[model samples]
Target chain A: MLITRVKKKDAILSLCKGKTLLIACFGCKEVHFEEKEYQALKEDLKTSNLNISGEIQLDYLCNDDYTNKRFELHKKEIDEAETIIIFSCGVGVQTFAGLIPGKTVLSGCDTYVLPGFSGFTPSSHDCEQCGECMLGFTVGICPVTACSKGLLNGQCGGAKKGKCEVSKNKDCGWERIYNRMTVLKKDDLTLKKMIRVRNYNK
Target chain B: MHFTELTKMGKFVITSELGPPKGFHIEKALHEAELVWPHVHAINVTDNQSSVMRLSGLAMCKVLKDKNIEPVFQVTCRDRNRLALQSDILSAALFGIDNLLLLTGDHTTLGDHKDAKPVFDLDSVSLAYMVKHLEEGKDLAGNALDGEPPKFCKGAVVSPCAEPLEPQLFKMEKKIKAGIQFFQTQAVYEADKFEKFMKRVKEFGVPVYVGIVVLKSVGMARFMNENVAGINVPDNIIEELKKDKEKTKSGQTGIEISARLIKELKPLCQGVHLMPLGWDDKVPEILKLSGIIAEKG
Candidate 1:
């Protein structure tokens, strides 16, 4: 599940106008929706003089068929609204926008990152699904997600004392890889075999 | 002179860096280069060092080339995409600049333009690979060049003081495989630590130049320790800079510290790359004190 935070009130208010429809996606079981904060934002929109045509809560806005079926149930409310505000991750916003053409669709939240697996089962690492996985060589620590720059070759010069320069609190991914290699006695092989350039086309 | 030829001849090379002026006027930058040109084999022109916007290093390299000075054109993967980077490489070749220093520059957030988009379309290793392919008369797409292809004595940067030195070594090896002829490391303060790094680096069989960044003051040294990555300014140097605080002779002290570092590191590496960080005028004095050059009569 992707972590996200609500965008600033003024930013959401700017896109909102007459007969605005609010759609909230709260399907991710692991993610908690701040119902109180959502209510507070609704109150804020009302104070800002925006006409609320209707409010709809749906599961998995990113799933096109589900969103399409839900939108059909609220066809009159969807058509009456001048603008649609979706409180979901970027993917869901884009999915909703693609389904409804010629309507002003704006995102009410911005997605941030979490350090866990992207798949359904929780794990310590994430796989960006770059098609070509180097987990076997890198000792299972994914540098693509662990390193801020997603550098595939190795560590950039910014790592210091086992910490990343980009985020001081985060452990340097390469340092982890190095420690793992040493423990497994694979440092020699790592030094000998050169990692090829990542096929970005993948 | 080609840097590759100098290294091949086993010459103890000395190189310094020049940061181009932010404005169009290149007079001051040229003057600074003139100060250390006599003392060093080649001068590296930084590409918006630290991600701060400045005059293009390529333009400064052309200016230096016109002055009959050898320039090591520094290219970073921060600003340009693959197409623009390839074009610039050819442009540098057209201007008769042969030496190239490839770097994965500091992120955009660290620069003056915080909101600017970073384009790491091709990283330092990939860039070196691109250069190798270009030298073979083709682009990365396997297209043939119409005429003579460009040749370069490619160099890359390494961080010797990295906490986990193995990864840096791993990347250095990759760079070597990518046709990088030599390496210039990030600022190294602890000679003992650098010595250890050099011991492993020797197995790679590529020339490694130890980097020496002058520490201007205790505050500056402390700031770098707290902020800059892959750099650890030792307490002894900080204390030395602190001793000069009363007399405001930190600048002199900085030169002395750098010269001392060069002396200690000289035996451990193939050459030294001095990064004066705006104290270009003091490079000559540092070189003389370090015994890299003879004192003027």
Candidate 2:
């Protein structure tokens, strides 16, 4: 599988933390990675006092059966694992529950919101799983997600220049939207003209 | 309307989940919810499911109500003290999301933000009681409401096959006393196990909508077997999938098993809750396979 080695350090640190075993199933495809980048990433983890007691394991599942087998082999151990960290792109993370049976499993995509993930902190407000996500329609950025200020309709004047008024490092929600629009070739639609999205469930 | 009314009519009550995003855009959250409108009987917007960040469940439920779908605004005490908890419940009613699901959410440490503090003011059972009190024109402190209290068809959760069925049964009894009119359980895998579990609790006379999580692949089946609590996947079924691993026919198998379970459990429960797990489009097929129609009523 071609594995891309960007942020290889984080991957290495993740494998080394708070758990006995770290199993990486890259799924059916190869993630592209430059060999040099992979080694350096590995070295960073080693320097950070990662115990490399043969606890870290990586696997490539080219076929579905192997995927099933890998889980079955570690099912018991995984269930008993203090913590199971899954790093798959697809919904495979949701399915992992059946194999190990009993352990806390957290999706990696969600992990990026942690305090350590640079400046991404969860907003003080809670998300009521309202069955709607209004990001794409609102200039390709979800006010609830990308915007730290939580202004449903527009940028919180607090977001000065391009930085969040809440934090200097975080990109203001509007700036992020602007950047996304530029990338998607839809920058012509500015936040000023953005209309309030009506209740979707209604 | 009381859940029994829908049950007596033999309606196929569909429920869907709205997973809140990890941060602050209410507009995006509402728009995403708009996708399943008019399809589900009630949309369950989770309250900090797994303790991850998202838009407020009450806010989302309010948004869902604006869309005219009955919102099951789930409330968990994992992040709030009783004072804030009671306030949010009132806020939910004020916002017009009538239904509420009480939960002791997953620990904060388990979520994306580990540094976040957790506030477990009360477990789900207590929350259920508080809801009942509010419905009875009384506050949590036993004070009377100024006007006629809001009536809620309160619901709580039950896992039929948890190792010690007695604890779950015990909790259910407490919930029943607390005025919980309906129940939706965790995912159901073993039909016979669930049947046996149901026998013990059916006497409560509350209608339970069996949770049928749609399995997309064997990988998913394996994952569920490995991680989720109070759930078990039969080895025979797993082995069967392995034998036909190359066929890529698990989706069909999933539908068949779900349909079979529904057919078997149909007589035992008031309804079935299809947790399509993002495969919402396939729910119709599974329902059809189980001889369930939308009723168009």
Interface RMSD of each: 1.9, 20.6
lDDT of 2 at A160: 37
DockQ of each: 0.33, 0.01
lDDT of 1 by residue, B1-297 (tens): 776677777778899999999998999999999998999999999999888999999999999999988899999988998789989999999999999999888878788998999877677788898899999999988899779999899999998987767778878888898899999999999998998998888888889999999877777888888888778888877777777585335378888888899999998988999999889999999999998862111
**Alpha carbon lDDT of each predicted model:** 0.79, 0.58
Q: Across all candidates, what is each one's fraction of true contacts kept? A: 0.54, 0.00
Question: For model 2, what is the alpha-carbon lDDT of residue A117?
Answer: 22
Estimate, for each residue in A108-130, the C-alpha lDDT of model 1 and write its tens digit.
Answer: 76554455745242323344545
**Reference-based lDDT, residue B179, model 2:** 71
Task: Identify the leading candidate in terms of DockQ.
Answer: 1
DockQ of 2: 0.01
lDDT of 2 by residue, B99-129 (tens): 7777756656557787776654456666777
